[model samples]
Structures are given as C-alpha cells and as structure tokens.
Target chain A: MLQAAFVLVGTIFFAAVVLAVFRIVRGPSILDRMIATDMLVATLICALAAEMVQHEHTRTLPVLLVLAMTAFLATVGVARYVTQQDRPGGPQAEGGAAEGSAEGGAAGDDAAAHDTTSGRAAR
Target chain B: MSAAELLDAGSVLFLFAAALLSLAAGIGIVRFPDPLSRMHAATKPQILGLVCALVALGLQAENGATVAALVPILAFQMLTAPVSAHMVGRAGYRTRHLRRDLLLRDELADAIDKAHADAAHHDVEPDLPGLVTDEDTSTPRP
Candidate 1:
C-alpha cells in the first residue's frame, strides 16, 4: 500500500510540474511568470517529499531547506526589482504598505499602516 | 502486513493528498486572471501543501536526526512565504500590473492617488531634524 500510494502521488505531482512549466513559458506578465515560478518551487518540494517516501530515505531533508530559502530570496529579489523604479513620493508612493495592509482589507492610510507594522516587526 | 507498514501507508496517503493541494496551487496560478489573485493562488495552498507533505515525511522518518532538521525548514518556510508574497504583490500593485476589474475591491487606488496629489503640492514633511546652518538656524541669545 505504501508503494502504491507513493507511485500515485508522484504521478500527480509530476503533472503539476508540467502545468507550472506551461505557465512560466506562456505567462502574460512578469508577475504572472514569477507566480508560476513560485508554484513550481512549491511543487518541487512536494515531489521531493513524495520521493522521500518512495526511497524510504530521510537524509535528503537538507535539500528541502535550501529550496525553501532560495525560493523566498528569489521572490523578494524580483519584487524589489519590479518596484525599483518608483520614487519615494511617486504615483505609487504608497504601494508597499498599501498592498500589504490591503491584504486585510484595511482602509487606513499607507504611512500609518506601515508605521504600525514596522513597529510590530521591530518588536 | 506489519503494523509499521500499515502506518507508513497512511502517511503516504497524506503525501498524495498534499500533492493534490499543490496541484490546485499550480492550476490557480495559471488560471487566475490577475497578479493579486495569482498571489493568493501562490501562498495559501502552497504553505498548506508544504506542511502536509512535511508532516507525512516526519511520520515516515525512523531517525530522529532527520525529523529534528526538518523542523527548522518548516519554520523558515512558514516565516518567509507570506513575506515574499507580500513583497511581490506590492511590487505588482506599484507597477500597475494588476487587473482592476477583476479585483473585488481596491482600497489602494484612491489612497495612492491622494498620496500623489499631496506630493505634487509639496505638503509632505521631510524627516531631517538634525541639520542646521547659520543662514536658517538661529542661535539662542543668552
């Protein structure tokens, strides 16, 4: 039963990788491509975990560490790159705080929102 | 079948279920119409998938070392994924890469426009309080 389920899960995650690759290739916008790549990283982690079951091995755990860390670094790097052109008070001056706080559907001013978050992060 | 083998089979089923959750993330990334929604696609299910898979891996591990090492990886992933998603979403919003029509509500648009308007009028305060010159700085008359 373990072997059977391992094979089945492996096949499904493989299909997921193929679809993520398709999106990375055909994505219409830069952020779209980034999102696809992030999903690809996630699927890769899942695949690795499934194979850990297949081989009945646990020594490959370090690979999972490196993958998750690098995926995060890549995402933050590309995001900063995308917004590099914005001036401090440009039309999108409030983008960072606005979008982050907007995730909670808040109606607070951007500066105030950031002030609170940064304070909390500092603590 | 042995009891240990039965236990391994159950964990493998968990691995399969996590694979399915990750499949939903991939499909949502490809099919979601905009960056914010795509970000939504990329975060929640991805984190859940990783947790589920990691849990199954832990269950299958006979050695304590591997399970101990896996804990930090899980912690780091939980910490960073949301921060990365927030950064990406903000960048997309700043660059106007979003499809406003697809968004249910945009609280940022007007706030951004207002910020710009306030900036154009030179109403923003710059936070430099330490610098002083003889021309604009007056000394106390003792």
Candidate 2:
C-alpha cells in the first residue's frame, strides 16, 4: 500500500515537470524561460528524493544534491548573460536601434542617451 | 496499531503530501506571468516540500549513516535555494527586462542603476558583492 501511494505521487510530480518544460519552451522572454528552468530543477530534485524513499536506496541523495547545484549555477549564468545583453553597447545594441541604417546606429545612440538622461533624472 | 505500523503510515502520508505540494509549486511557476510571481511559487514551495519529504525519509531510514547523510542535504538546500533566487531576481532587475506592472515598487532597481552609473563615471567595473569575478572589463576583449 505504501509503495503504491508513492508511485502515484511520483507520477503526478513527473507530470508537473512536463508542464514546466512546456512553459520553458514557450516563454516569451528570456527571464520567463530562466524562471521555468529553475522550477524544473527543483521538481527534479524532489522526484529523486521521493524515489530514494520508495526504494530504500540511500545513494540517490548525493546525486540529487549534485543535480540541484548544477541547475542553480546554470540559472545564475543565464540570468547574468541576459542582464549583460540588455546593457548599452552590449550584444543587443543593434536590436535597440530605431532604423536600419547609420540612422539606426544613431537611434541606438539616442536610446543610450535617453537611458542616461532618465537615469540622471531619477537620482 | 503497532509502533512500526504507525511510523509506516505517517511516512507514507507525509511523502504523498510533499510530492503533491511540489507538483503544485511547479505548476505555479510555469503558469505565472512574471518573474517575481514565479519566484513566489518557486522558493517557498520547493523548500517546504523538500523539508517534508526529508522528514519522511528520516522516519523511514533504518540506520545512523543514512540519517547523517540526509541531514546535510536538507541543511544545504535550506540555505542555498533562497540565495539562488535572490541572485536571479537581482540579475533580472539589473537588466531592466523584468515586467514593471508586476512590481509594486522596486528600490533595488534604483540602487543598481545608481551603482552602475557611479561605476561608469569612475571607469570602474561594478562587481556584485560576494560574487566570483572571472574577467576584468577594464581590459580590451580579444
């Protein structure tokens, strides 16, 4: 009876992980995607720990920790990359441009100017 | 009921509840539209669910070695999950990509921008406190 109950709960947790994966794939923004990934990692850790209890296996706990730590690092890395890209003169500078010519380059410069101006005003 | 039977019943019930709560937390993260809300779903549920599951495991564990191993895993997770969430949220705020309508007010956003501006004026690379830095931005990248 106990084993059956665990299997049922484990299946539900697995389904939730699948739902989170769908969101990660479909998230409109990079931030949303990172958030989904972080949630997915946590769910995976719980599932592994549950399995260890059901099977009476002690080895799986360390494996779960390693996986969680790796996922945490990956989420932080992606968040850092996204923040860096959004900075002025960063990789997404072109995307911030208003036109497709030297005018576009000027427009990107204007955006940077606006950012600095607003940044100053807020101070 | 016997002592062994009672322990078995409690362990099974706790494990089941923990698993369900974890699943709900995952669903909340996926369904929430913004970073802060998703974070709300992520941090609390994950920590609580893990604690309950670990407790259940502790109850079922037969020996001292198994209990010893489980305790550190629980402790480390309790400490680390929140720190990681804070880092991700700070990064999102610094990038200015987080959805604004979702926030009531953001004092951290103001602070980060001010720090960045100050660093820019001084020609210094702003380093996040306690973070390990790999590259110095003052040098030209090859």
Residue pairs with clashing backbones, model 1: none
Candidate 1 lDDT tens digits, A46-88: 7888888778887678899988777888878877776422322
- Regions of candidate 1 where Cα sits further than 4 Å from its true position: A83-123, B113-122, B125-142
Residue-by-residue lDDT tens digits, candidate 1, B1-142: 8878776877787887788887787778777766678788776446888888888888887888878887887888888788788887877765555544466777865665666577768977433232122222122111
RMSD from true fold, candidate 1: 13.1
RMSD of each: 13.1, 8.2
TM-score for predicted model 2 compared with the true structure: 0.71
Q: lDDT by residue for model 2 over B29-140, one digit each (tens)?
A: 7767556677777664467777777787888788888878877777777676776787778765555444455567878647767877899999998765532222332222
DockQ, each predicted model: 0.28, 0.28
Per-model C-alpha lDDT, please?
0.68, 0.65
